[model samples]
Target: MRILDRNIIKYKFSFLLSCLLLLSGEAFSEQQRVSLRWKPSQGAESYLIELSEDRDFLRVHHFYKTKNFRYEFNSQDSKFYVRVVGINADGGRGVSSPIISLADKFAAAPKVKVERPSTVVASSEELRISLGDPKTSGPSSNTPGSPNSQKQVPVSTYYRVNGGEWQRYDGSISLSQEGWNEVEFYSEDILGNKETPKKTKYLKDTTAPQVRLIGEKKGQSGLIEIKSGAELTLQVTEEGSGMEEITINLAARDGSGAEVNLTLSGEEAKQPIKISSSGIDGLSILRWEANDKAGNYIQSELPLLIDAKHPLCVFAPTEGKLREDGIYYLKENGLIAIRCEDPGTGSGLSKLEYKIGNGSIQSYQNPIGFNTGIHTVTVYTSDRVGNKAELKIKVNAIKPDWQKTGSELQEK
Candidate 1:
């Protein structure tokens, strides 16, 4: 008999729970009062209502118990989640109702449109958007304000071309599908608000001005040895939005103070600018900007590999005499240096790191000499393109031969 009673109780609880969840989720204005209503459960004597801002009822903000099926809630944001339960006269508790948010309780739909980037996507493919309509008061996006000053902000959803996955639109929007593509966009705000979807149609052209450079930037990747000057010629071809103008500027990166600049405009732009690598060697930056008739522009930059030769490195002691074992003896202490030079390049020798005997590696700036000790000098150097050379020489400072001879006679 007890088992039968337990089963009966469970069935009654489940029945009431179902009734609570079956209520209408939307808010209705009755007698000028906003409220939610539901049908009463069969065996329930009273209903329990729960409301919260979160989908999960863990942080329920309001709780109500009443005999009537209708429940009035205090919702400031008009946005909330709700659930209900029923309690019977026999102490049977019904299941909880399915949770629903009230954010759209009294909101209207929205209309979106493509506002900026000139409606057409020729110059740029990215889109700027704005929202319209959905009547609501208090800090709303539609409130009266300056065209530049916005009173409220809305959450936007982006539907890229080809019915792609939707994402929150953070002001700037883009269409992945180029050419003529149909993209959808919409916006919605909290507090019972949302907008309808608006489709945007446009075209995208991403082609830039074509470039034809001399030597084709190939077959010169290995060791570059240029004794004389290198002449560069360039040609540009553009279709659709014809080229308005083109300019190129070159800057040296080796801190050798080298620069090249050129600009051409209008019908006189057919002639290519001259680029002479006579003095400007090493790594150089070449920037080109081309403007079209449709107010569109293209910018391009390439690291120019100028034709130049590596510097010649020679180990000639500034002041020392050659001795045995590749060692040079300095009669006294002074200075000595390894000479390096790049005859044709603009930026000359790039690297000059050397390691002296039992000493840390240092950049060879000026001449190097020992105060009073046997010295082993090993130097490593290279040009901008990594043309490397190494040299090792041992040097020593010794007493003068006259001093040694005089000392020997006195001792005898």
Candidate 2:
């Protein structure tokens, strides 16, 4: 019976010792670890950890974790509970703290606000817009983790002119004309937060085209002469807007202002105005009036001197002896050089007028071919500037070896 009692006491003592060891192991394990850990769910990798006085969602303690969390809590304060939730990532995940105490505190979530562009002006040429802070009316502070913050949101602008199509503007866009217009702008942040639509209206177009003349003055006389049976010329030009047409009205006037009108036509053409008469010879005034399609005009006048006269040539012999031989022959080919000038002061010789003996009146510049004989030569000259001269010559062609046949022949 004594052995049985001793064995029973040993067994009881062994059981109590095993219980103490198990309890101590559990206490040490609890001291070493304070929180739970798990792989974050999809879209919930980055999380915000919140501490509360209790799990009832009543009095919030602090923002425990603000960045991506591999949660582990080591705190030594009044016992508190925490819950963690992801903001942007996708997941049905939530973690809560088994009430604990911690020495360090967590920061709270930052407050968020938005800023917009001020006085955006829209035009057909350009859109001028500026951004300012909502609080200070200056550049918005974009510091990380700040409450009043903004991202340089990629914005696309669109424009509609008087209910026209909305053209998208990637950066800056220009307006086309001067008037009121509506503009709509869209902006989105990296976090998928979108701004409300912005709109405005403004004026545009502040320029004009330059213009000038390419040719001479209006109504100016061209470098052309006017005479009976002659053609007149006129030149006109316009620098800008191009030359479309030129109309010219030409007229012939007598001393009494009685004029006959003629029409000339061309679209930038070098036109020739014609004049003719029915044998009445007198001074006439030729006038030309010109105008461009742009309603510009100019007038000019030229004095037309007219005369009707036939040319005549006179012949004169130089100081040379005539041969006594009935067949006159001299040492050299003697010439009856003729000088002809126009007799009419207002008309010109159309060509050099000449005649040899009783031959037909023709035109010649140099002397005509002459044989050893008594020949008569005449020439006439005339100018359009009202000038004339005439000359004639008699040539006694003789052989170099001939002498006077008789004194009567020489005297004659």
Candidate 3:
């Protein structure tokens, strides 16, 4: 027998497995049946088939000799590299065919498409996915068959959300979580070839941002008071999708109003938002509005009283006469008291307190009486909106004039 040229045998071996690989696995089953066929080569009496997990074929998994040109086997999610060699009449081996991988003969991974990046308020999020291989064709490809062509008919698909149990994918999936969502999916072809599992993430924000309004002081009747030219600020926060915008609507008692929208980006968003009280005074309303990236919104209103004057309090003796030196000379059994007043358009008086020298402070509900001694008194007062004042007074109650006159008469 003439020795065949190495290049010629290699070229002839290339066409030896014409349309040799075919996958005929059961529907939705793990056991897959694969079929292989080849053309007869000249001067060959039988064929040799080799299967391995490695490309170099150093670790051969299976070897078989047959006179026929077709073979069948069952694969349980196993991939292989295959080659064919020709046998001479005298039992000599010919050049081997080029290596081929079962992976190239299998379908690709499934494709997933999200309808929306995130769910907004009153809106639904839909997820659409396909089991067909993107590499073979877009979806459910109908490509023609050839020696190198691969069959990519997808049979079943499975998916899980947020680490839940695996469920068969039949239709669109809905996302309902408040924030980011985790999803995993995979598919199997008719050849029982399982695709590598894939993971994806998306958002589902549906809550609005939160806002806090801060003022100089708060008092009874839900009133917040601030001084003229005082700067005010608001604290805005978001839990999902982040803050998108902040707006302030200011309405004054004089029927004038203004609106301002804040920019939330870079260094500007980090800075405190100051609402100036430069020209507007008296009672005014501040309306705060905030929104998140998912279109959730919230609004609130704050009532402010802008006053520049401090409240005033006075001390007097109920049963005594005021002397020229601003001191009070009390008669026997005399009492002292205090009074507080507010300036024009100011918050009303809230509290009054007094204390003797080095004594604990007491709320002034009634007149105060001192012992038979010269004493110093300190008084504190405040208005409804935190305007405060203090006063100190001297009282002479050690020896009343009436008591002295009685003593002098007794001496006579």
Candidate 4:
């Protein structure tokens, strides 16, 4: 009769011999032999090997009866548990050794790490990669002849940039590309275990934001002339790292007054703003600075002169001179013309009208001629923004030379 009770066999053996896991042939090759060896028992003639997918050994994967004390097999998965039992020649089973997990004793894959910037940058930066020991979990067996008991070091590190050819990592890498970049890396240990490939990404921006000024009334002599309540627009754009902030400084050109400073966000800076001449009248300088997310900036200045007052009007003789006798003498073609100018900054003349003594109002396109007597001229003018000015001038003029000669001949 065969003795098959495992309970009787468990108490019959005093101690189970220590087990050893060894690897033969190439480290990670397909034909590598994963062997389990143990000390021979006194009354055992053959050994029984049992490999299970679970730790409890409830589900046996492989059962083999061998005459030798060692068993060799190829591992299809990364991890499993195995146990060995001593069998007597009478078909009776001896004590079974404790189940050992292959994952706790096998050589592990190397760990790879890539270091790069986390934020957006304005220029190229350096990238570096390193290799380290693989991480392990659970309590280590720390038994003699165990793979985890010894230290393992990575032998090589490999990397690729932007999906290009793979290369061994030797030194620091530079991200010189203008746009987005990607780097993939892996490490191999001395045991020929390769780590899973890892990827990292970053951005490199070398262009600055574009700035433009619009909605100005006119530009002249390195200055942008505007009315009191004119609209000025500042436009800024960036394609790479979007816009960040814009700062505007308005200071008096003469450097004798305080400055008016304003700040705007990326979205708000693209709209039009009103420039009031109530406080900042006369000549002023508008300096602006625009910045992007990549820490790149552009600075510029625009000279501005605010015109807030009405235009000045005056009447002057074109070809006549005032005599000592309180009368003004002029040639036959002598005439008086209206001259108009802005009081502050120039907003340009919009309307210039004049009337001779109680005459009908007329646009002042040419100089006005008067009869041989004292006369009064009324002038009215306005600027582009409706700033008006009116003036009245008294002029004393004599007849022309030809008229005076005809009068002398008539008297003779």
Best by lDDT: 4
Model 3 stretches astray by more than 4 angstroms: 1-157, 189-194, 215-217, 253-267, 308-345, 349-412
Candidate 4, residue 317: how far the Cα is off, in Å = 6.6
Q: For candidate 2, which ten residues in a row score worst on lDDT?
A: 15-24
Residue-level lDDT of model 2, residues 1-412, one tens digit each, is: 0011112122101111000000011111332113223223334434445556565758654543323222333222125555545544353434332232222221111212213211112111222322211222222335478554663433333444445676654333345544344555544434454445555443321221122222222221222222334343444443322232333333334434234556544443333333443242345555555432222234566555444444556443353444554322333655444455445434545567778788888877654556676776666665553335565655666556666565544553
Q: Which stretches of candidate 4 lie over 4 Å from their true place?
A: 1-119, 125-152, 217-222, 256-258, 266-278, 317-336, 343-351, 355-361, 369-378, 382-412
Poorest stretch of ten by lDDT in candidate 4: 129-138
Rank order by lDDT, top first? 4, 3, 1, 2
lDDT of 1 by residue, 1-412 (tens): 0011112234454322211111111123111112444445678776666666688777865554545444332223246666667788876778765554555542421223322322222333332222222233223456355342355654445445557777665433455444455667665655434566766554343455676565543324332333225666667766544455788776666656567687786664555556665666556666787654323455687766563555677766666877777777776655677788754543357788788887899998888877676888888877654556777888887655443333444553
Which stretches in model 1 have alpha-carbon errors above 4 Å?
1-206, 216-228, 307-310, 315-412
Q: Rate the local accuracy (lDDT) of all candidates.
A: 0.54, 0.39, 0.60, 0.60
lDDT of 3 by residue, 205-322 (tens): 5555677765455754457877656677876667775565677766566664333334454234434677776555567778776655444556788778766556787667878877
| TM-score-based ranking | 4, 3, 1, 2
Least well predicted 10-residue stretch by lDDT in candidate 3: 119-128
Error of 2 at 317 (Å): 5.4
Provide the TM-score for each candidate, comma-separated: 0.30, 0.26, 0.43, 0.51
